[model samples]
Target: MNMNVAERQGDCHSQLLSSHNARDLLNSVDAFLFDCDGVIWKGDTLIDGVSQTLDMLRSKGKKLVFVTNNSTKSRRQYAKKFQSLGISVSEDEIFCSSFAAAMFLKVNNFPREKKVYVIGEEGILEELQLAGFTGLGGPEDGKKTVQLKPNCLFEHDKTVGAVVVGLDQYINYYKLQYGTLCIRENLGCLFIATNQDAVGHMTDLQEWPGAGCMVAAICGSTQKEPIVVGKPSTFLMDFLQQKFQISCSKMCMVGDRLDTDVLFGKNAGCKTLLVFSGVTSHSTLHDPSNSIEPDYCTNKLSDILELLGP
Candidate 1:
């Protein structure tokens, strides 16, 4: 029988792996999409029992994909991090917003002769290069300052075709000015945002300003919205579906954030699991004003094994 909206909410509210049919739920999904920063590791630290749980899942023949909205690291860099943490993740198994941004440009047939103006770090630049695109302005322009004197002339590259914005630790007036000119003045210059997450775990201690801050700066100056290529956009989901040839119904998304991770899975028509080891708390999930809900809730990812194992 079909349950009403209230009943459904009630059911989901009580659907923690500890009390639910976890073994059946785990058996139903062929693949799992994981959000990295909070769900897998906080900063450089790995979550407890994560390695054992992942090994158990692999033993059961389940595929795993690490889908992260962090644009600060390329797939190769992510793989290295995984290795350093003793997690057996491959480069192809990782999907980051940096790679998504580059893939968006490539699949859209961006002009090869033109350059991409970067507002982020080496991650975006590396992905752009790997995608056969030249990237300009990043750490190289971090120390550059603008002269506010009267009649000061600022010369920006005319060959710039698109301005890609991500999480830039060294965000400054010069880079923003350059990006604004390209988008506002350059004909047909595309503005692309890796992700618009409001906050991120830049460190394990606290949340910091995310890529949205940088994207918003360019958006305000250009008076234009960017093509978001990360989670909640379904771009990465589409890419993953094609690359993995997996059906959305047979996949489960596990993450820590409701706005991005859970919402992304819901948008992509997959089962969603919310965990509390990251940015969100249990009270935040049950707040009266909160609308987004996942199919399941757990204290941590390792609960899949601890709660379900015999």
Candidate 2:
């Protein structure tokens, strides 16, 4: 018997995975959607037993798709990171929010003549270029300072059709001004956000402000909410579904973020497994105020291997 979302959440909210159920879950899913930062690694350091667990899953013929909300890197950059961590992953197996932002524009038939104004990093620019769109005002405007004079005219590119915001390490007033001008001044200009994660593991030592901060700056100036293309939106999920010819029921989303990762899985009708190796904590998961819950909870991704035995 199949259960509704509410019923399923109520029945197995944060249910710890054991050998019996681990084997059952393993056999039930044909694909796994993983959030990179928390589930597979934290910052630059790969999680212990991750490569082995991924190998085990691959050995079972489960399709692996690394879906990340981090927009700081392109698919190629992510592939390099995977290689550095000693995990074999192809660029095709990675789906990042930066790539999703570019895909959203392409799939929507955005005019090729108009360019995109970026308020993020090179990742956004790279993806936009790969999608055959020109991107302006990323790190190029990082050192630019706008001097406000009495009659000074603040001019921006009129050909910009969209403003894409992501995790920008070099965020500055100049980029924000350019992006805001494009969104607010340009007619019918689209405001697109990669993700709205509040915080992320920017470095191995600690968390840092995420793309939401950059998006919020633009939102504050333009007074327009952006169309999010990342997790919890199902935009990427739809793309993945069509590309892989897989149903949501046959995939499991593994991550450490409840708001983005787990909620994304639930929204997409996929099974969710939350690991406590990143942003989320045990108390936070069980908090009464927390409505979103994963179908299963484990200490880490490798716990599946331990639970399943040899």
Candidate 3:
């Protein structure tokens, strides 16, 4: 633990969830919320002892809920990945930005006549389709491009009323051109993004541009910000509370990012545990400029087992 963090929240901040008061903290929370990409696994590899820690927690009758800002995979797909990784998670145990995006449109009473122009992946498209929304401009278009010649014209679907952006690995100038035109040309057009994370760690040492990068491009051109539905929004937290009938006070959010995960937990009135296995480093947390802080901090997910006992 850093001296600065200790001073801000004191040495007894949430009891540190250490061996001294781990039992009390564990007993207090009925459920544990997790952020997937950083906390559990890094890319296709599972972090050491993550499965064991989760299993141990589950054995104690604690409910596990995964809240992720990743809009690339739908809940079903996420479940499949969990099975492959030996995590034993169900579809209901997962909530993602893709599902949140679909729910947002549904709750807003989006017209059936209007379709969504997707700047994302198959997961987002599947969610939209399941939500009874027709989506356009996905990987189905392949690498198609339109020439901006003097006498050339670009054709767009007139019925696309909402432009939904997510983590699209196949992002291109053509997609950006079309997405920009849709928001600029259409009246009452809705622009939305799954998250605004600038960069996502592809691996322990490699980083890739996230959805926010592409969303920023569109925003720059259209001068319109999107209605984000991912972490730190509190919409998903509200959705989970309503869906699972769980109280915010009885939950703890564990993640590796301070801005999204810690801030989300803070906004939702839940205890937050920060792990130093991903984006944030100890020095980063120690920085005075950093505003977001978690109730407890540890080296990794497995460290929680110290409180669980042998």
RMSD of each: 3.2, 4.0, 2.9
lDDT of 3 by residue, 51-136 (tens): 99999999999999999888888899999999999989998899999999998999999998998998988888988998899989
- Segments in model 1 whose C-alpha atoms lie over 4 Å from true places: 1-14
- Which prediction has the highest TM-score against the true structure? 2
> Between prediction 1 and prediction 3, which has the larger TM-score?
1
Instruction: Return the TM-score for candidate 1, rounded to 2 decimals.
Output: 0.95
**Model 3 reaches what TM-score against the true structure?**
0.94
> How many clashes show up per model?
0, 0, 0
lDDT of each: 0.91, 0.92, 0.86
| Least well predicted 10-residue stretch by lDDT in candidate 1 | 5-14
Tens digits of per-residue lDDT, candidate 1, 1-310, equal: 8656555445345367663567877889999999998899988889898998899999989999999999999999999999999988999999999999999999999999999999999999999999999999988899999999999999999999999999999999999999999999999999999999988889888899999999999999999999999887899988888889999999999999998999999998999999898999977787655788888888898989897765
Report the Cα lDDT for candidate 1.
0.91
lDDT winner, 2 or 3: 2
* Candidate 1: residue 117 lDDT (0-100): 98
Residue 124 error, candidate 1, Å: 0.4
* Count of backbone collisions within predicted model 3: 0
